[model samples]
Target chain A: MTPEQENQIRESFDHQSMMTTFGASLDDLTPGTCRISAPILDGNQQQHGFGHAALTFGLGDTAAGYAAMSVMEPGHEVLTAEIKISLVSPAKGYRLIAEGTVLRAGRRLITVEAKVFAKDAGENRLIAVLLGTMVPVKPKPTAT
Target chain B: MTPEQENQIRESFDHQSMMTTFGASLDDLTPGTCRISAPILDGNQQQHGFGHAALTFGLGDTAAGYAAMSVMEPGHEVLTAEIKISLVSPAKGYRLIAEGTVLRAGRRLITVEAKVFAKDAGENRLIAVLLGTMVPVKPKPTAT
Candidate 1:
């Protein structure tokens, strides 16, 4: 990816307050691919003290959206049109990592997928997989 | 729904820290339906100052899970196997409400769906719809 494109993705990601709330960070970026990780916190757990599926889905969705954005034209933004996720295993770990890849990039719709892994003691276990479609749109005008 | 069943659902929900972090509340419950709502907080927003898709999906998923739980046998719990969501409109509003219902209940897997609405100025607009499968499981033993 061009330096300008990388800068754009980082700037856009910085504006997402949800990522901040979850303590998620962008770990890597490349053309049509993105990786994100977040530590598992007590506030993000389900009844059984495992990482909530919402946490998994949130990270995966954002990572996938950024992957689509990476391949889009300058100043273009992407929005999720639809997403599906399957929980393959319990998320029992200290942190979660999501790797997203673009399957197809079109003028209007982009297909993306993400694999989420739970990391415990440096071991990673696959926990969930997500597939989604993103729509490219011109950035909305900022308030003056 | 029986009072015992309602109490069981409420107690189970109270154990979910993710719901507490989102400030989501169980608003209603019946034999095979559940409703949940949460205010749109600044911490849960996307880059465009709108409600994040994570918030919508979290509410919908939990509501649908609870709907499945409402009809399960005693000592049984439900976990999401897979879920798919379509964002029909931008989530721009004061709060989001998700109403979930069981489409079909079975011994192993239950089919469920949820409709999410964005509420602003006492008006509601359809924002998203979700379909999912829930698997019934015996409650895990708590730590002694």
Candidate 2:
């Protein structure tokens, strides 16, 4: 993907409401992969000080969406068709990172996988795994 | 489920950070079933004025968790082990509702499903579906 394409994807993340609500941000974007990260905020945690699964899932799914977008053409956007996430371990850390990779990219359909890791004091532990399918679509009229 | 059990789950939802952040509320709780609802807010929508996928997923997953909790013993809580959500249609509405039902309850795991509906002008449309595995866990020390 070109730099313009990458910038386009990043800008869309700005319009994603749940990402902002969870204090999440897009960290990296490559040809067929993306990384989204969020802090373990006091207002976004569950009972055990672990990152709430909802927030974790949001970051992971957004990463998958952007990863799929990275592989598509610039004018086209992507929407999630389906997403599955399994929590392997409790995410208790200062920050969480979701790394998404496109497994297959078809004309209309794309399959992506994201792995979320919890980083505490420079040590990272795998916390969750996500699998999703994204579909390319024309830009919405309201695209900001 | 007993009234005592319902109250316990209700109290727990009060402490769930993400639910509060999303302005979500538990609308109903019964044995093997739950309903969670949230309003469409400007800070939590996607490009088309639809509720962001993450917000919808969070509502669905919380309903699934509470549904499983309702069927379990009083001192036992539930956590999401795995979750899958499929976006069937765009959610353009004033409010979103997720109704969750338990499919099976096992010794250690419970399977549940949630259907998300978007309501506009008193008309409702199915927008998404969620399936989840919830595992029973001991109550946290701070649980009310």
Candidate 3:
């Protein structure tokens, strides 16, 4: 990634509000890769005694979005244009870990894959796997 | 749509803990078709004074899932394996309306497309468009 791209990625990561909702943050983000974490909340539970699908989805999306952004040009913003998540196991835990890898990066779109896992009860099971497509747009040029 | 599939779609629609969480019903679902509504809620707002992305994505996924389910057999289930939502406008105060259409239905995966809109001040503007892939699974046969 270009130096300008790295700064843009950092700025983008810092401006997100959804992270506050999930208590999630980027642990490590580099060109083509990223790791995200969040703690489950009481509101994340469903009647089936697992984290709601929406919460898991949100975390997975974040990881994929950031990973895609990491690989983009400096001043380009990555927006999720499409994604798929497969739930493999119940999410019953305090913390969720999401790691995303860039599969294909193009001028217009980036494809990212992510896996979400829960750590609790001394067992770590994959909760969800996500496939996301991100669109990249040039940032508005400075007025100066 | 098969009669068995219709019944299964109804069953999926009927199983909801938060009944008020969604607007409309099975009557609104059809293969390559859908209708969805979301009530106005203060908690569903984002910083842009519009509905949260979570709410929009949930409604979009439900519509797509149900639309896919409407084309399957009674004992089968349609699970959302992938989705992509783009935000074009702020959610605003209007009730959200979503329409999901089947793009392709294959033996392994069904692709559905969804559009989200809001009746903003009596005008509907596209907010997000999502493409989803729904996976179908077989159901157990009845006991003899």
Candidate 4:
């Protein structure tokens, strides 16, 4: 897809939706890469007063999903078939950024990896990592 | 760990701190085995209005983590090192149950499998499945 078309497709992810209810936004997207960010909020706090594990994982998956979608065909859609998010460090900060890339693309599935970094005290720390599989929807043949 | 202590630890993972927060309470615990369950909530919806993929993974990982803890010796703790959750169906339902089992227990890590099922209009649907690795923490010796 052309750069203009790719930008339009990235816009369709709707980062403001519930999956990103805590204020997530996509900053960049390309053929096989994506970057999203979210600001930490009191509402997202767990007992630890840090970003909840659930929220952290959500952000990472969103990045990975978008990364896979960027490389897929225009008519093809990608959905998570499987995923794994590992919490490496507690997320305690004002903002977090997730960078994701497509590791492999296949006919039926795509593999992606995402890493989340939290901005803390003006320093960035790796907080989480995610690996996931995205399954592409098969297009139905059009009858002429 | 003693069977009695195991019971208490299992219960702790279940008590909810908030209505939106659901947890799997330990219903049963034995060496190398554990069972827990939690209800699904709309607030946990992902971008597609289905149960969030990350939440599903967390539940699976928690189940696997606790199951690994059940079989560890006293003073040992368990943490999820890695997890893979498969989303088979849209997690539409009232409740989701995850049954976890220890597939292989090693001195350093334990492998566990979790099956997530949702009750859909009185029919059971396999919504997700998970495989996780739990790292065991050994107690440190105190200086005399």
TM-score of chain B of each: 0.95, 0.93, 0.84, 0.81
- When summed lDDT is taken over every stretch of 10 residues in candidate 4 chain B, the lowest stretch is B11-20
Comparing candidate 1 with candidate 2, which one achieves the higher lDDT? Answer: 1
Sorted into a CAPRI-style docking class, model 3 comes out as incorrect
Candidate DockQ values, in order, are 0.69, 0.63, 0.19, 0.25
Candidate 1 lDDT tens digits, A1-144: 678889988987888888888899999999999999998888888888888888999999999999999999877888999999999998898999999999999998999999999999889999999999999888757621
lDDT tens string, model 2, A47-144? Answer: 56678887788889988889999999888988999999999988888999999999999998999999999998899999999998999999768645
lDDT of each: 0.91, 0.88, 0.71, 0.71
Against the true structure, what is each candidate's TM-score?
Answer: 0.97, 0.95, 0.67, 0.78
Instruction: Enumerate residue pairs that collide in model 2.
Output: none
Give me the candidate number with maximum DockQ.
1
Cα error, residue B104 of model 2, in Å, equals 0.9
The DockQ of predicted model 1 stands at 0.69
Q: What share of the true interface contacts does each candidate keep?
A: 0.78, 0.70, 0.18, 0.31
- Please tell me how candidate 1 rates in CAPRI terms: medium
Question: Model 3, range A34-70, lDDT digits (tens) per residue?
Answer: 8888877655444334565666777787788878988
| C-alpha positional error of residue A7 in candidate 1 after TM-score superposition, expressed in Å | 1.5
The predicted structure with the larger TM-score, 1 or 2, is: 1
User: Which of 3 and 4 is the better model by TM-score?
Assistant: 4
Put down candidate 2 lDDT per residue, B60-133, tens digits, no spaces: 99898899999997788888999999999988889999999999999899999999999988999999999989
Better of 1 and 2 by DockQ: 1
